[model samples]
Target: MDIATLYNANINNITTAKNAFDVLATTFGKATEAWQHEIADRLTAEHWTGTTATSAGTQIKNLGSELQAAHQELSFVSKALADAAEGFAAAQAHLISALDDAKNAKLNVAPDGRLTWDNESTSPNFAGTDAEATAKEISKRITAALNEADHADQAIEQRLSHLAYNASSGTGLDAATVKQDQAAVAARDQVPATGTDPDGVKRWWDGLTEAQQQRFILNHPDQVGNLDGVPAIARDQANRINLQRSKQDLQLQLDHLGPEPAHTVKAGRGSVENADYSAWRTKHDDLQEKLHSINDIESRLAGDKLKFRDNTPAFLLGFDTKGKGRAIVSVNNPDTADNVVTFVPGTTSRFGTASGDVDKADEMARAAKQADSTKTTATIAWVGYDAPQSILPEAAYESWAQNAEKDLARFQIGLRSTHEGTPSHNVLMGHSYGSTTVGYTMRDHNLPVDDVVLVGSPGVGVDHAKDLNIDPSHVYVARGGDDIGIAIAAGTLNFGLDPTWDSFGAKHLPAGNSDHNHYWVKDSPSVRAFGEVAAGTWRL
Candidate 1:
């Protein structure tokens, strides 16, 4: 297209983008306000009871959540489009201004692109003046203006590139992926690490348009989900989407493989078909296990009677299918809670076993509520690491814990960053090998938590509480009567010092006469102690 045609087309495009943005902004505002009002009204109404209230609350919360997500998505796209439009407009203005300046200077271009002074004008003729110098100056101004226009054009191109991803096309850049990419680009330089500017990171996150924030959640969930300085809600949303996508992809693979074997195999030597089948079976089984874990999460969120009685609602904050699989679910929204407790499981912990861990988390949540009914409590079941699959040599080593330290530390940071109003009294509670992970995390990096609780721990990867970098007084230890193996291993295996032992110098809490697995059981002394600790009411 000719330059004039291109310019006009760009103007029209900018106008269209701005108009679309305005429409979205209006709709988003109205919808969000309506959702908030509906939820508020439902929460305040006193006439509902039992199932009615439960169902209504769930539906209202879902609606509000959907509305909020839609708003964020729209906001990001609109802002991006608006920005692109403004860029194009500025470029056009620059070009126009340059042309006007040329005219004011009494400079004229012949049809063959030769420059000359306007003879008809009363301004000084180029013939007598320093014509070469004046021409050079005019040329310089025009070049700068063109350069500005070129930069703006490039900006518009970049913006359009992001907008071009659509599901209808075969480019595979769906809405979620597009959002994710945007977030990734925006956060590419702001990743949180040791010595990084945390406040600056937070400001960058806060400065993101809602769309960018949503996109970040959608695209780089693993990064955002575990990022120390991201809000809990964003993490939760991102994690959930990631989890669902993972499940869908796995299911699709399984479907492609079919329910039964492709062909009947002979019982003898391994063939290519057999190898393929074996690989497929392994993948299929792994996928099934992961799905089971996801189902457990869904059940908890749905308030299954068998899994939980409190129906406290659950929010998935992180998930992964790599290796043994990892999941993080909160019993309630941690962002608005008064107390938050994260429970990390030990050996044999995987997505398949996540249900039991989630149940334990629920129990912890209940206990916290029991300790202080007025206070809101959120207990997170953080299976966000590859735990030892069994009580083998691997379980005895510190590698697992070492590998998990950074993730655990970052998860704590995420909680602290996302929390609203006064910060929650956050506690990290670990059982068995999980305690080792928590210990390593505290030792390797600073975790912003009010307290650290170790129960039935083999060792904390440290010889004493002082080595943990946490205030000795803030470290609490409890051991069940039946955890004799863990007690013995603490000294024998160089797994570090036993926090429960007198030499470890951590506050001792009652574990009751229970087994290692029962430490978090409702009404158990260990559970009560955990409740007290989580509520910030624990005493020596």
Candidate 2:
């Protein structure tokens, strides 16, 4: 068979199918258009005869059916074209195979009908050379190594699965989904104190005394699986011994373990470990402080914004203050140009939200002012607009971002008017949706600001810091490990607001802790980085 001719036939079939589909689609389109025109004409008829109307209605119905059928036929033709193309490729492959077989054919004429090849000389006929022996040894070693490796890998996988099951079954913490975790913990706890360790449990049994091991095994009879190649007598004895020991240890722990603290609310669906008490206290204290400070802050929001005067230039009253919202004007020519910091809050972000009972927005400003208080810098909480109440009913991120942009623009314009002659450097700080606002302002509004500090950011809504239309070197980001929002904000696609701008190919300040809407305070990694930036050292 001619391969080219066979391929041509297949190609012709596909082309014909495709052409048929196209023609059907065109016909359907034209028929629909004509039917619509005919319907319009029939509606406008002056001689409303019943027969004439019926014929026109019949024509419309028939045309509609024809169009539907054409659409269906086009779909069939398209599928047929695809099938024909595949068939053509298969035919091409078969033709090539047949041609190859015909060229390489070997006819047998011997009485026994045995087949032979002219290229038989090339076949290996090893006669025990040193190289051949060495090759064979290498091959044998390689096979053994591969087998060992596969076994090791499979063993590890099986052991890990067992461990997962044991961990999932942990005592006193088992929920419906975590039974396997309980099992995992039980497996570890039930380990036999066999002086000869279980195969994969050497790590867990390392430091137990023989007596303790024997006791642990005694109490956990049901936990034993295979004895990991140990002698049957020894393994059974070890399991009995270890189980008894575990019972004693658990009883001793229970006796000493104090009752849960009155205010110790659980963090998640897990047992409170020994170290969590301190964490619980710290959070509790922080929350209390937040509650106490908010009321004091709400009283301060009613007045007009303030400014100060210092004698670096002989009673210069107004210096470097151009923007909307309240301003924290620094008096003297402090070492750093950025002697003032402005916070632009996002949607629904107001004075009361930061703390349960206190005006947290104002409290943060006061804390910032008190933090670095030689008049070197001051902080302003710019709640320029009434933020959206809730994200669900009305305040979506995008909608708030748009609202923030408008207000931030007005605020920036107002600030520019305030500091028309003053020349102090400026820093714009934002959080969560506020970061979006800041990013949009810098990129879209072209606000003249020095540095932008973003904490607990979801995303700046820009691809990179440079894309925010600001000086890339001045953008800073921070995220804490325990932050609930970080999971959703840390990825490129999800925009979980990861602070990995430096590693993710953008210039930014050192990342700090910004988890669950809480910015890290003094002594925190993020706070230290913020201090560095506030002091005008951008490299941190």
Candidate 3:
């Protein structure tokens, strides 16, 4: 396809198909769920009994499962159409802009994207001295647009080819649809060689239609929920869908396990003799822990949007259920706030054990409000990285901080890129080894925060405040008199120089003999002082 042909591509037809498939997917899923509820209502353990009842229940479940599988297939196709439409739209816009530039330069662009001098003679258009160079630039852009459109077309053709695929399955048409989708999935693997810059991500997001964005969020929530540079509200909504879906999946897995055995037989050195029992036990335990972690997150959300001390809604900016898990949540929209403070919790604050950290973020917002009620403040609990799981084994390694650098930088950049109003005063704080993550990220990336706060730090991975990315005067440190482990770690382990040390030349906050874990205690001087800093009213 050439520039003119691609520019006039029928994206509207793809969008119409996408909308139709989207509705079909939603109907299938809702119908399955409704049927499940009806089955549960009818199949009472006390009343429904017998071989016939058991057979009926099993068949009923298979029907629901088939519908659910069909929903997945339809959703994938819908998203494929949405992706194709957006890709074509972007290419069309690119071509249009290039054409406009060519027209302004008084160049005649052909249908095949060839450019010539508009004066009907080989003459320069007065852009640069060389007319050939200007023509080449316009021609290059047109070529790029055409190439982009071709790539989109190739992907869509493969994704839509599932319509003709057949699979040999006893479960019939739904089974065939599910099987075909697997090949379609493999076909659309265009690959991600390098990540887009956060600014570029914002530009792409800005170019998307609302319907396109919604399809992305609904069909690919895992990607959209964690993506930087997207709006917080959209991220929150996507994450909530992800959270509920995960919980439901875990619950289903658990229910499928049925009841546990009365006794377990052990063999050899201590392993279970029964393979079935061992498998069931292992699966049950893993699922239970994951579910528990999810429950903790749900509690933090407080049945709806995470409510702070005030009625302000907190947004779940990101979440994951894998391994130790991760969560990034903010207690108010940073886009609308006058001040934004992001608190990175240190050791032992994994998703399952993050309630305390979330509470601290909440307290930080309240403290900021107390300092300057006139200004709106948003405090975020950023558990975006897998912090050192324990002090003895994990905290001692700088590797954890090293691994988190890119994600942390992107997250901070996202906050800056997505802000809607006047630039807000931004503060980044880290406690204990989290200070290590902040320090590494700062050293590596030009994080957009205005100030840095290191509290109860082992070290900031810098020998002096001047070594940090920000001005040395913008660095602030607060250390509790009773923060013994951190003090010892800073003095001996050599993560770097202690920020609170006078030689380091960083500003100070009053710690006043507090402990390592007491910084965010309600109404405490420490939380209030941190809040004041966030509110842009703190003094040395």
Candidate 4:
């Protein structure tokens, strides 16, 4: 019963646990590979229509069961290894107790394995003299060992959770199958079984005058008869032809009935030539005045602000009015402007705040500027429009989405004009509710862009980036680790929440894995990656 003996036993225990972990890691890795292949094969069968619907369903169920078993095995091994590591410390405790006994027996061993202490013969107590130092060293070693064990446990747990996350989402691989099924159902519903067309031939009959409609129905009684058993396309074509004939007959009746009602032209009206000249002059004057006013405003504004000073150009636009919101443009190299980053802020963004000169989009523009000073990048803080005040009120009312569409249109027109002659790598970056704004905008307006980056986004409501009219390959998303918004979006339990960040379909850069949306620092990997997008160095 000695200190050296206990330490050696504890070391052996640790070695055994480490060996167990190694074996478990290998087994779990193989299980993961197998499950991955199974899922892929099942999907391939589904994709190619190689299996019946029932068969695919059965395969999915079986795969899920297998994945669950694999996951359980991994979890079990991880826990066992962790427990064994803890048991090693417990064995060390027993060794410590034995050492106390040996010390009480008035014996101690030196580093060279020689007996160095004899408590019975000492003038002063030898055991008490060295107990404090020995105990301190033992406690330090125990703390270090415990920390290593905890670190190892955490590493395994994180890997398991990440694997579980992937297995559950099945995003990129299954989205097309789901979309196809939904589309098929909708197409089936739109075609009626009992009628030739859903609109019906009755609509064609109803278009004529009452007498004419009745006469036509009688003359074309067979066409007016039940349309069932007729092809929908044939019925549709027949209805269209009948409507065209009825319109011609009605026009003939109108032509025959019309000639008597027009009584006169005013006697004082001038000759055609004189009157036309006067009208033409009036129109010319009006257009001239408009042109002059526009020129005046353009000249005044041009003198007041720097004109294309940076490679970036500022966009000034008004909502329901002309000329109001401010946008600042700065390029990394005024001489060789390369990348252009347009920041669209969400919810209550304005210019010249007490905290700074811009809000929302402008705030992001500032961050872009700070991110890289020499990258020949242009950061535009665009208060694209007076955005809604909050998401809650807007979320409750769907009309906000319509307004967002309009704002997107206006911003795009303005952006196109601002970049009139310049070719720069353009990115439309949105944050928070701004992402939703961008989604609606891109869907409604075709803005020329190289990349679209969403940060701290809520659900964008687009199933995919392509749904927003942007190339799916160019869409990028990032969420910080602590971002609370990511949790909200992910847990919305609705597929419409922006899945780009969590799915494999689009390129989503790593956000700091933050818990809160607002606190992700610019220095974090996610932000730096975003910065790379802004710089046009990162391919989406």
Q: Measure candidate 2: CA RMSD.
A: 35.5
Instruction: In angstroms, give how far residue 357 of model 4 lies from its true place.
Output: 8.5
Top lDDT prediction, candidate number: 3
The residue pairs found clashing in candidate 3 are none
Q: What is the C-alpha lDDT of each candidate?
A: 0.73, 0.46, 0.80, 0.49
lDDT of 3: 0.80
Residue-wise C-alpha lDDT for candidate 3, range 1-540, written one tens digit per residue: 976577677879889999999888888788878877777556754487789988987887677767677667667778778888888888888889999988887778888777877443444554445557888998999897787777777756765564434223433247655766665454333211124566766655654544456667888788778888888988898999998998998899899988886445667667455667777788788788778877766766665424435466778898887877888889889888999988898888787666668788889898899899999999999988888878988789899999988988888898888899788899999998899899989988878989999999989888888777899888889888888878988887668887778998899898878889888888877888999999999976
Better of 1 and 2 by TM-score: 1
**Model 1 ranges with Cα > 4 A deviation:** 1-201, 218-226, 258-281, 303-309
lDDT of 4 by residue, 277-296 (tens): 55555544433433333332
lDDT ranking, best first:
3, 1, 4, 2
Give the per-residue lDDT digits (tens) of candidate 2, residues 302-376: 222121111121111111111221111222222232354556665455433422211223333334344454435
Model 3 regions lying over 4 Å from their true place: 1-194, 256-286, 302-308
State how far residue 46 of model 4 sits from its true place (Å).
Answer: 94
lDDT of 1 at 474: 91
Where does candidate 2 stray beyond 4 Å?
1-295, 298-338, 346-348, 354-375, 386-388, 391-396, 420-422, 489-514
- In candidate 2 the C-alpha lDDT for residue 375 amounts to 34
lDDT of 1 by residue, 1-540 (tens): 123532354567666876887797688779789768776575857566798888987877766665554555455566656655554555556556655665666677443324677454354643335545666776665554455455555654654564454323523223455466567545533445532444455656765544345556776776676555666677777777777788788788777876555544667675345666677788888878888777767767664743446567788777777888878888888989999999999999987789898888878888888888899889999998999888878788999999888778767876776788998899998898999999889888877887899988889888889888888899999987887888787767777866787888999899877777888777988888888888777777
Model 4: lowest-lDDT 10 consecutive positions = 315-324
